[model samples]
Every structure is written in C-alpha cells, then in structure tokens.
Target: MMRRNDGCTILHAAVIGKCYSLAIGISESYPDLAGKRNEKGKTALHLLAAKPESFRSGSAYTLRGLGMKSLIPLLILRTIIYCCIPVLYKESQPVNSAEEPSNSASIHKLSRRSSFANYILGFPWLKEIDDARQSHAVAVMLAEKLIRREDWSHYVHTEFKVLEGSQFGISSEKKNRMPDPLIQATRLGIIEVVQEILSVYPEAAYTFDGKGRNILQIAVEEEKWFLYDYLMTSGTNMDRMLSAIDHEGNSIIHLAAHQESPPSTPPGVLEMMWEVLWFKRVQYDSYPYLWHLQNSDGKTAKQVFETNHASLREKAEETVRALANTVLIVSVLIATINFAAIFTVPGGFDQTTGEAIFLKNRRWEFSLLMFYLAGGLFSSLFTMGTLLVIIFLRFETEDFYVSLPCYYVINIISIFYSAVLAIVACCQALIVQKVVITDFRPLVVLFFIYGLMALVLMETSYVIFDYAYHLIRYCLCYRGQES
Candidate 1:
C-alpha cells in the first residue's frame, strides 16, 4: 500500500524490476493500480511502453531462437529428480497423527496438499520461471486491463508535442506529460503494443506524436516495413492515414521517400533498388494528387526522393558496373571451360569414323553429357551478351531504377544456369569415363551439388522476382490511371 517518494507504487516497481509475475499478481489484486499515474504522470503502461524489451516485438530472441528452448528439457529432467526425491523422503518419514490437525498449521498443510495434487496432475512442481514470457504476458495483460477500463486515453495523447526536456522530467511546466505509449511503441518498432492498442481502441490510430505524425507515418519514417505492411493489411483505417500530414506538411508518401535503405536490405545496388521500390509502393498507394504535394520546404515526394537517393543511385551505378565486370569474367571462364570439354569427349574418338566411342557404348551418358555441355555453352554466351549490354548502357539515374536491375537479373540467371550445366556435365563425364563407380559416393556428390544449386536459386531468385512484381504492378496501376 505504501508508495515511493516519487509516487511509484508496488506495481511500477515490479514492472521496472522485470518481476513480471509479481507485477501481474499486483495488477490482478489492485486493478486500479494499473491506471494510476506516478509523480511523472506515467502509468505502468507507459513504463512498459518505454521498455520494449518486455515484448517479443522489442526483443530479437524468438520462441524457437530463445536459449531456453535448448535448456527446457534438461530443466524438466532436473525437476523430475527434485520432485521424486522429496516425495520418496516424505513417504519414509513417520506420520505424526497428533500434530496433523493444528488450527494454525492447516494453511501449511493445505499448501502441501495442493502441491501434491499438482504433482499428480502430470505438471512439474518445480519449474523454471521464464522472465521473457512472463514479462510479455504482463505487458499484454496490462494493456488489455487499461484499455478495458478506459484509462489509456490519458496516456495516449491526441495532439501533445513531446518536449525536449519532458523525457528527463526537467520541465516543471510539462513534467506531468510523458511520451504517448502508442507513439513510443511505433517509434521503437514494438508492433505488439501498437497492435494491442489498435485492436481494442481503433481510434488510437488517429493519435499523433510531437511531430504530428501518426503510427502509420512513424512506421514509414522509421523504416519499419513489417509494421507498415501490417498496418496496411490490418484494415485499421490505413486509407485515411494516406492523407494525414505532419507539422512539416509531409504526408505518408513524403515520409516514405525520406527513409534510407532499411537495415535488412543488402548494401550497394540492391539497397538503392529497394529504396526506389519502397518510394514507388508508397506513391502508388496514396492519392495521385499527394504525389506532387509539397511539404513545408516546398519539396514534393519525388523531390524528397531525389534529394535523399542521389548518392545511393550513383553508388548503385558503380556497383552494377563492378558486378557486370565480375560476371563478364565468370561468363568467359565458363565459356572456355565448356568449349574445351566439347573437343575432348568423355571417351576417345574412334579413329576409323571420327565418332565418339561412348556414343555407341554408353549412349545415354554420352548423349546427356553432350546435351549438358551444349546447354552450358549457350548459357555462357547468353550471359556474356547480357553483360555487354549492361556494360555499354547509359548509366543514368532513371536507368538504374528499372533497366539496370532487369538486365542484372538476366545476367545473374544466365550465369547460374551456365554454372549448373557445367557442373552437371562434369559429373556426367565422370560417369561416362568410369573414373568412379556410379555408386553411393557419386550419387551423394551429385545430390549435394543439386541441393546447393537449388538453395542458391531460391535465395537470389526471390529478390529479383519480388522487385519485378512490384515494378509491374506499379506500371499497370499507372497505366490504368492514365486510361
């Protein structure tokens, strides 16, 4: 019941200490405490919001990735040993009938009885408490209780500007106004907290932070693509947010343009391509008129994009040139290797007819080897042609956006195909030459090669295909609008 000098209650202490079980217990016992603000006008939810580490969205360790995942089995084994030993020891002790029913000891007896009962129910009487799970549970529980009680409105400001000194509680005039939980969560990429707030109170999506930016705007500016995609797909009044502008007169599109390459995106040309794709996605999603709408600085979203992405585009050009040069060398190497393989067939030529000896003896292997070699040579030549096209093209900014990437995709695919064919043809040649028996070892090696090729194909193909899909969709939409 006692409070700290700063007015923080036991609930706040429990949350701050990461004692989620005690926090949950306290909140359940005193629901009103969850709604109470400390001296700083920050509720327990505000504290929870500030500590993103409490939620899964804030932490990097997933359920499968958690270190505890490996330790759970061992902990359970230890618990079984501890539980069984105590039961065995208690069974050996003499039952004292005279001391069984004392009035003051009944509670202790009942506690033991419940423990024994739980032991019989196939549950571990001794279990390790997972602080991460407990903390997340407490966070969700508090959010639900606070929202259901309508206590969240005070903490989620509508138009309050987060002052500079307000965070440190140094501004006596506005010391009571803490950061809004929704805005803080959005800025921190805590989608769980943001989702919980919007699920219960859809109106919270309308709340803005100090910059007059809502959760959607913040997501775009912060480059939280996962959160942004969720908001777009959740049907949480996202269409309305497209028109919302901040104090700087920057709409969601403008904010999207201002974001640098996301950390998850690869550096170099892919980063530049991702930035261009992101801008186009946002521009197409918004009303067409908003595309040209200028911010306070009199800069439209396109201008904002140009200003931010100029260096990225130039770097992307250099990267493409470098990549093309490298792939060109690879293509030539593959061409030469495959070309030499054709002259020296797997088996020596029959001197009488100048025919491949394996052509008649190991017909299938020879045919397959020849087919694979021909394919490899064709693919290598095609890749070389594409690389030349890419190398000679005008490296303008606009070309980097679409033309460069498309040509690069062709070059990469051709190179991959050529490499695979060459490797397969080599394996086939081995089979024809009988260098090694067509037994376990060769089959394993062949399988390993195919598996590795498939994995590389999956990894690189997805990004190329994704970029293409978005570009095509944007073009189609633009053409539809034009018509």
Candidate 2:
C-alpha cells in the first residue's frame, strides 16, 4: 500500500497533498521509506517541487473588489497626511570595530565546522544517493526549519554531494534533472528559504542557474529587493557576486534595466519610482565600469534602460498630461464657484449700510465666509499656476523624481483647501441663517462631515481616472500581443 506502480509511495502521496504531518508520521514509523524510489526513480522530494494550484484562480475577482473598496479611502487619507508632513532621511551609522577572537574561541569555531562537515558527510541518504532529483527541495525546507529552531553556526559548514546520472537505467538524455534548490528558491523569490540554504551552504551563492545567471543576477532580474539586499549584507564574497555576467553577457546593471510592467492597480508613478530605485541600487552595488560595459548587442546598461523604459516614459508623459488637465479643469471650476460665492454672500447686504448684513451683527460668520472665499481663490490660483508651469516645462526621466512629487503635492493641497472652503461656507450659512441648532457643536460636526464628503469625491475621481488609464493600457497591451 505504501508503494505504487509509478514508483509513488505513501510519502509521495502525502507530500503531493501537502500533508506534512502524515509524511512525518510515515517517515518516523518507516525510516527506510525515506530512501524508497517510485518506478520512475523519483523520490518523494521531487513531488514537492511541483507547482501548487494558485488560489487566485478562484478568489481573484472577490479579492480585487475588496481591494478596490478600501484603496480610495486609504489613498485619500495617505495623501492628506503626506501633504501635511515632510520626510527626513537619516544618516547611516558607522560600523564599530570587533575585538579579536581568543584561542579558545578559535578552537570552538574549528570544532563546530568539523562537526557540521561530519554531519553532512555522514548522512547516508545525502551521500552516494542517486535518483534523489527533488531531494534538495526537501533538504532546503528542512534546513530552513532547522535554522529557525537551531543556531546558524550548526549548519554553516554543511555540504551535499552532486550525483551524476539517471538512477533508473533510463537514457541519460531523457532524465528529469533538478536545478540547485538555492537557484530555484532564488528565482521563486522565497527569501527565507534561500537565506537558510545560503547561510548553511555559502558556496551555493556561487552556483549559477541554467541561464548562466548567478543569485545576484536572478535577484536583479526578478526585482526581488529583499533577496538582493540580503545577499549584499549576507557577508558573502561581494566582488564575485557583483561582477558575474550571464550567458548573454548581461551584467547586473544590464539585467536591472529590463523593466516588466507593474501590476495593473499600482499607479504609474509608483512603478516608475520602483524602476528608478532598482537601477540606482544596482548601480551603487556594481563596479563603476559596469555602466559602460556593453552586452552582446553592443548597448550599455544605460542604453538598455532607455530602450526598455521608452514605453514607460511615454505612459508617464500621458499620465502627467491627464493629471495636469484634470487638475486645471477642477481648479478652474472651483475658482468659478468661489468667484460666484463671493458676490452672493451668505447673508444679504444691509439695505442702509450697503455692507453685508452679518458684517456688524455676525462678525464671526462674516469673517469665516471671507476667509473661506479668500483661501479657495488663493488655492485655485496656485494650482492653476503650478499646472501651467508643469504643462510648459520639459520633463525628462530625471526630472520626474522631483517634478512628479511636486505636482501630486500641489494637487492634494488644492483639493484640501477647496474642501476646507466648502466646510467653512456651509458652517457660515448655517450660523447666519439662524438654523434650529443653538449649539455650534453640531455645525462643527457637519463641517467635518462635509470635509470628509469632499475628500471622498476627490478620491473617487482619482480612482475613476486610474481605472480608465488601466483599461486603455490593458486594451493596447492585449492588441499588441494579438498582433
């Protein structure tokens, strides 16, 4: 019952079903079963490498709807807060010198290394084992769990033997070979799993995948910032890792230049920022000469970036245009409304004095109305001026970092000022009209409610614009693919 015709054992079935508890139970009772092979000469470990069905297939639409529900409110809140505050960058602290190890400490380190080596060389299944194609996957998973439970030094020196041929007497050319687990994990962006494998087997960092790409290259290509940052500080040989060139003669910088389209929901600005961040990080990490090094196509890293990001740059320009137009139109409308409100004061003019009726009797209401009108007019004018400058200015890729943020800030401020004006106008009207409310507290609460409604309106407009942009972009992409 434990072994099947296709060489699948009960352990294989358990692993396939992701029933770790059952696999452990079977392994404990039949320890020898760990060495058992199915008819195809594959072990239970191989089954673990098969891809799992994505939960997205069933729940993607629901999740997307939920995300959209929360996105606008969060963005509105974040935008308001961000405009109100400035971010500060902190200087990095210098590293302190470490004291030299004593003779006893040296001896202990040596003993630990020896013990780890012995543990690896002594493991029967790990040594002289053939047909353990997927064994590395199991080893990596176990190693991660062990690292979590135990100390890093315990497995720092462990190693495994690389077997050479098909174990089941099948043609060598037809054998299903497994790539190094570290490379596989790195490609998959499994940071914890890769970290465990590399910590115990530092030499694995030097291993290349089938594409002749190293860990750093994979991290750069995949945009796995967490993994890339980890490797940088992981105390490995940095020079070798940074200097690696893949089969296509593409360096780390070259790989970083190739941008994939971001998920449809992320704003274009954020996607551009991420691409810029990746380029800067890779540039900082690699040798300065890497910038000039050309790939097989005779294009420098900078050239590759320019070529790849051409479409993105165009899209960004389009977004900038749309944003400018939207802000300008909204500003004009607000300015027009405020202009009209100024003439039609909340309180009618005094028949004898030829001034506002509330000017002398209700000075506070008059003052609030004046302040609201003035603020709204000033904000609208400022927004229009900014939009004019943006529309006339030439925005290259380098300019986006500074200019785009400024535009967004101005837009938020304009919306906020307009919202405040609306709230103030509402409150002043209620106060001057002698509404049923005696307590001003309800008016204040109503002001807040009006402000919130304004924010919701502004945010809803942004969401609509973003979705429209995405829909158009998707249609274009689909058409391009079809063509």
Best by TM-score: 1
Clash pairs, model 1 backbone: none
lDDT of 2 at 215: 81
Q: What tens digits encode model 1's per-residue C-alpha lDDT throughout 76-121?
A: 4544443343221111122445343221111011124356635654
- lDDT, candidates in the order shown: 0.70, 0.59
lDDT over C-alpha atoms for residue 120 of model 2: 62
In model 1, the worst 10-residue window by lDDT is 102-111
- For 1-483, candidate 2 gives per-residue lDDT tens digits of 546778788877877776544564465445455556577654554344332211111111222222244555653443343233221211222234224211111100111325564476356643322112123233334333323322223212234233346221111111113334456556655565666667666766766666667788898897765567788879998776777666677888999998953233355654665576567557766777777888878888989998998878778777777778887898898888887888888668988878998888878867877788878888888888888887777767765544565566666667667756766666666766777364868666876777786666655455334433433443353321110
TM-score of each: 0.74, 0.64
Q: Choose the strongest candidate by lDDT.
A: 1
